[model samples]
Target: MARRVPRPAGAGAWGRSMGQGLLRKSKIGDNKSTQVDLWGGACMVRQVENVLLVLEYFAERRAPATVAEMTDHFGWPRSSAFNIVSTLAERGYLYEPRARGAYYPTPRWLTMAQAVSEADPVPAALTRVLDRLVDETGETAWIARASGLHVVMLDVRESPQMLRYVARPGMRLPIHVTGSGQALMARMATAEREALLKRIRYQAYNRNSPMEAETVRQQIADSEERGWFMSNSAFSSDLAGVALPIRIDGHAYAVTTAGPENRFVPRMPEIAAAIRGAVAAECGAGALDMTPLRAEA
Candidate 1:
């Protein structure tokens, strides 16, 4: 050890404080850099990639995987494994048996994954048309894709109104009550329609009318004959909507417009034409050019 020397008299006391501060800052800087390097290994993008890989494996194997299995496979903490599994199960991509400690991919997961994997062209075309409908109508528009025993709202564009509608993407509405539901059901083969109707649960509240299975069937038939579906105070007392089916490449997609009932019913023909034009453009046609005024007669 070196011998300590006495400080010179009149040395600036502030200089001594500055020297001590510098030494403390150097120690803190080193510790902070080490911490960042350690935690940076679990970046969000890498975490998502790992989750996707795990899902793909589950899809391929069609087997239940436990949190312990995920932890061991992904080298992730137990909490992360549990979170991923629970979220996937809640989203209907995975099924978790009560107290089973394992999860299996559901049929829904397989269907959606297959659709995305196939790069279905119909959806891409339908999206363009939905966008134009929103632009032309200035009311919220939606594209609903049919799923097993249900119709899922695939996408929705909001109206620029301060008080707009409440449809959301990925929201599932029962197939027996909504205009989008009726439009698609009307196009389904007779056998399929009957099978689906059997499983539906009709929701009716006080003073709200409920449709019987037969009534639902008749409404669907009328929608097909008229080439459009329209309702005033159906879903809500003040809201009205009109919908048309976009039949492309044998796939049925629906477009719907909703707004205040007073505005919607008076201009029902205009709104219907906007939706039809949007659908026609999606099919790569010149223009719909067909006025609802003529079609209504």
Candidate 2:
């Protein structure tokens, strides 16, 4: 049996549940654990999370991993762990630098990641707009697009301040409470917006965050008239944000500026204008493309 992580409590844990205890054990899953079958899918696929966890192991260990070591760490059968590691080596993602040595990842994965980032849907025009926001507001600036019920940060330029918001690319924020999420959700067609809203697993980290759909609806309605939205300590006690949606290359996305509440709220007017002005200046009538930045499962 593979070792299991103790899942964190509450709504956030949904982001990490990848393989739900593969088929029950092969000498390789004990044939059930390494590859999991979807609830009704006709074809079963190898658990992608295995590959990710393997990579994470390498990253944290900073050392090559042998098949025996992999099996012991994950509680997998030796053969299964061997197969998984060998498959990665066969794919050019991993290599045995030393003959008869343990395997380590090659640069292929990094090269592929660079290629994908270059091909991102966010165009140079929008990135320039994000850059301008970061410069003008001295707060972290980012571009976000909706993925199902969450907003994903596609590109970000962090603030230079000593206590600025640190934004990670590909981070997901819930739709109902984040300014970026709200901006993107509000721009969706009414039916689509309402449907997505109904699916929200709402929670509040602080008093300022709206904990119900109706509250968010009212917030969106009010922001619709103003053309921008704000989240005051919504995701966490200190994080605050402001955003305005824009269309670039025929797709919709939001440009957001965020920072610690103490410093960020006072600069909201300045940050908001920077975002709006940059979009107007760089894009003119162009729209933001919002195709998923990740492969949909």
Candidate 3:
């Protein structure tokens, strides 16, 4: 089994139950623990924690930290400290210069970690809800979140029909052209909404999809009035999407939907209710629900 890093001193022991146990065993896991460290050798949990701390510090902002910084932070023996980091580098979790010993997380680590997190319960729960939506209405389902002046399609389950919504991860669309984006905009403050609009250019990418700044503002007002956002060929020429914001602690993180122009219009009310019900059930009325973020709203 791989060893896990211990929780930091200030973090409540009770709150760190799962994380600390993994540290004791020397492994970090997603759902089921995959034993990456199979040497059956006892690894120092504190050393692992120190390394993870360094990795997190880098992950947050992408600055390379020196060995001195890590050692000062953990107070571990130099040899053990270097070895732990070296092991992580070898496993593609981090990258370090051979001479300088400065370290940063590798793309491989981010990719693997993203895969694990997506498969974990939070996103899994969202996916299950989306799947149920597809089963219930025989339509495409989407879960999207605001990213900059656009909406990022996080996850989607396509309808079984020959012509269905075919969007993938990392797909970003302009906020003005998307129902999901408009729903999020409906809940944002005026300054934030205007700032976002200013940041994104109102360039006409296609002939029928002309969205000026004023038009976008009007759409947001309409969404707020209707309690939902609806678009017929607002994004794609033939596709429509209906969206509602996912709020946790009065902040909007994302929107959930049943879409694809073919099914969105006729099923707007039902899909909107499904999305509302799912968000309410999944997030509840907690202030601390979902991962913390500065740009949640």
Candidate 4:
């Protein structure tokens, strides 16, 4: 821990590379890492890891935890657990609602988390686009951004239809097969996209799913030509999706409308048009791009 120092104002790729490495070396692989804590146990910084795990425990247990409970939960010595919990209590992150009672996290934790998330919250215009897609197409709509080889749904608007693709924020979808994933990849530089494509583990989510990088590359290529993306690809075998890539401050994100194939497939062209119109109307013409997203090397 003493060996590394903080990155300065102009940190280079080493900083970016370190962050990417943490995401890439997930014990659960590229897909599940973000779905869990942003980088939790995967972070080599041990002290921080313990704190996140403690918070997650409180979250899961949904009950105030005594020091003894913490001890038993983490298998730490009573003194070690007491010290950790005590430190958090002193810092106002944890407290006993009743004296001599179990310790519970304070609102400070939630407020601070909210502050951080809101600092770079999803664009408001994108929210409008998602709502528009739901209104126009009457299907589940989600906005996702590429996270490693998966696209993490940042927000979701469920369809009113009885048989729709029920999705939620924080759902992770395979990068190679999802329409949101394909649109996101299409916005990346060719070399970067190729590198990610090569690393993809193309599972046969369905008999028609692409099984190779070339196939996916061609999909992106076709998407670049079509100006939007659509797929029968699914997290559930019977679902289908349409996605359009948009860039916000140079970051790639996709807004998608998805549902059961029986209903969604027949309306693919209409849905894609709706998505494109919504993006153009709510996000402005500049928000959509066909030029590759290139980060400074």
Candidate 5:
């Protein structure tokens, strides 16, 4: 079970009082500093945190958590914990399987998550492909789509290992530096790719990163020929990743596998093979069509 952070006395009241004021200020500023403020003053959203933490605790443990358990883990007052849990129960996000017993998250959360995933352009047909890749390779797998000058992770299936690379869904990476970025670039038309390259401000994120346009273009060509892109310590010294382009409905997407360098480097071929096999089995030859996105008029 994951341990929770401790809260000081009167923290709940302080959180409730400050939360309203902070919410008002956040709407006005709406800047980068607002994120810092929210994280730094997380105590102000203690009630919200309590609800999320309870849900996470249930997920990690695969069991229900009682009010007392939540109170002890978060160091929250018993009454505060009870109120938060009770509110969630009332909201249908959680349910008590037994009277005065532990609480568990309901299917409502999963349903909403599935709905959100379906709303993305990647299509639901690829979910099993990502899941199979993770199962076979024991590494994180993701589907990313190019968005302007950055590649955004549309969906992700995390590795089950205790120590693994985990990038959150919707996380963005530069188009000029990441393996997924290169894979996506490889599938685009020469003119479109060049246009995007010119717009990119290529700065090295690590010693291995290709900061020059010529070197990046060569890498993209290599990936185009090999049908996959691989990078070790390019974006982050401790991480390595492999990606392959998958085209769906004329949009380019990259399926990627990432993990700590020590584990990912040696298993590169195995990971690549797993991804190829998953894509072939799930999507078939029709899915390999790499038609470039038509330039918007």
Candidate 6:
């Protein structure tokens, strides 16, 4: 028989030690010894933030800026700043004339913004109507659109009085609480109104706020009977308001005027007439095609 070769001394122990070291290293990950360079550690996209910062800097300056000026202002390295400026110039957003020249934002940005602004129909139509309504009523006039179970004030023209009700654009109110909400419900079809009524959460905001469904339904019926809707201390104890429903391009909207209760309640009829006249003048008689509730009766 062949002689058995003797195994190397401590070879098994050495192999075990090497295996354990590898396992420990894998568990700890590469965070300890690896000095990751600037672009290698995090895989997040920071280019968007850099681009926005460049645009904002240009906007604040309102004049052309060279790459060196931008680097100094932003504390960025010269190479990084140059790359950002070059990329922006390559795109249509920035324009430069010479090889080493100042960069300016192109008219493309302004033209895009103007196009977006003009595309929105609400601002153009409601602005003209609210201006005249404010002049005629001398109270805060506003336009509100229905958003789910809430009414959002899209625009407002504040009253020129020392103690007038104040409302800001983008203020959201419960659909069951405000005069605009009631007018919107009144203008809806019967089936749709009933469906929406079920979704409303009836909470008593104040003593005057209608908390019961039956009471709210009665108020909606009353609003439908009249061409407009009114509320006195219903939303706030010291506030009163009147609202008229308007239809534009098959969308339902409400125009409202509100002020301190003592001043607004007495002039409800005048405010209602002013809103109607303003709508007629701005939108034309075709908008008045919605039959008045009394005519149906």
Q: Write the per-residue lDDT of candidate 2 for residues 8-127, one digit (tens) a residue.
A: 111111121111111111131121223321121223244676777677567545777778777876777888888888888888999987776688999998999889887866788888
Q: Write the per-residue lDDT of candidate 4 for residues 24-109, one digit (tens) a residue.
A: 12221111322222221233676675676678667646678888877776667888788788899999999998777599999999
Better of 2 and 5 by TM-score: 2
Go through the candidates in order and give the C-alpha RMSD of each one to the true structure: 21.9, 9.3, 16.3, 10.3, 10.9, 22.8
Q: How well is each residue in 9-74 modelled by candidate 5, as lDDT tens digits?
A: 211121112210011122111221211121212244666655665665565457777888777665
Which ten residues in a row are the worst by lDDT in model 4? Answer: 11-20
Give lDDT per model, in order.
Answer: 0.60, 0.69, 0.58, 0.72, 0.70, 0.68
lDDT per residue, candidate 1, 1-297, as tens digits? 112211211111222111100111112112221101111122347667556756645643456878887677556789988888888888887787656778887788668867984784436767787779778887777888677655677777766664445454555555666677777776666777788788775544112224578878877777767768765554445666788765654467678888766666788889988888777767654232222111111
Task: Point out where model 3 deviates above 4 Å.
Answer: 1-111, 114-124, 206-210, 249-251, 258-262, 285-297
Q: How much is 264 displaced in model 1, in angstroms?
A: 1.6
Candidate 6 lDDT tens digits, 227-270? 67888777556778889888777677788988777877888888
Q: What TM-score does candidate 5 reach? A: 0.62
Off by over 4 Å in 4: 1-105
Q: What does candidate 3's lDDT look like per residue over 1-297, in tens digits?
A: 234333222211122121101121222211233112211233547645466566644543346767666665556677877787788888887777456878877788668767986663235556776777777667666777776767766776666654455544445676666777777776666777778777666654334454677888887677766767777665445666667766553456455554445556787888777766765666553421332234542
Give me the overall lDDT of model 2. 0.69
Of the candidates numbered 4 and 5, which has the greater TM-score value?
Answer: 4
TM-score pick, better of 1 and 2: 2
Q: What is the lDDT of residue 245 in candidate 3?
A: 66
Order the candidates by lDDT, highest first — what do you get?
4, 5, 2, 6, 1, 3
TM-score against truth, every candidate: 0.55, 0.71, 0.54, 0.67, 0.62, 0.59
Worst lDDT 10-window in candidate 2: 11-20
Q: After superposition, how far is residue 72 of candidate 5 from its true place, in Å?
A: 19
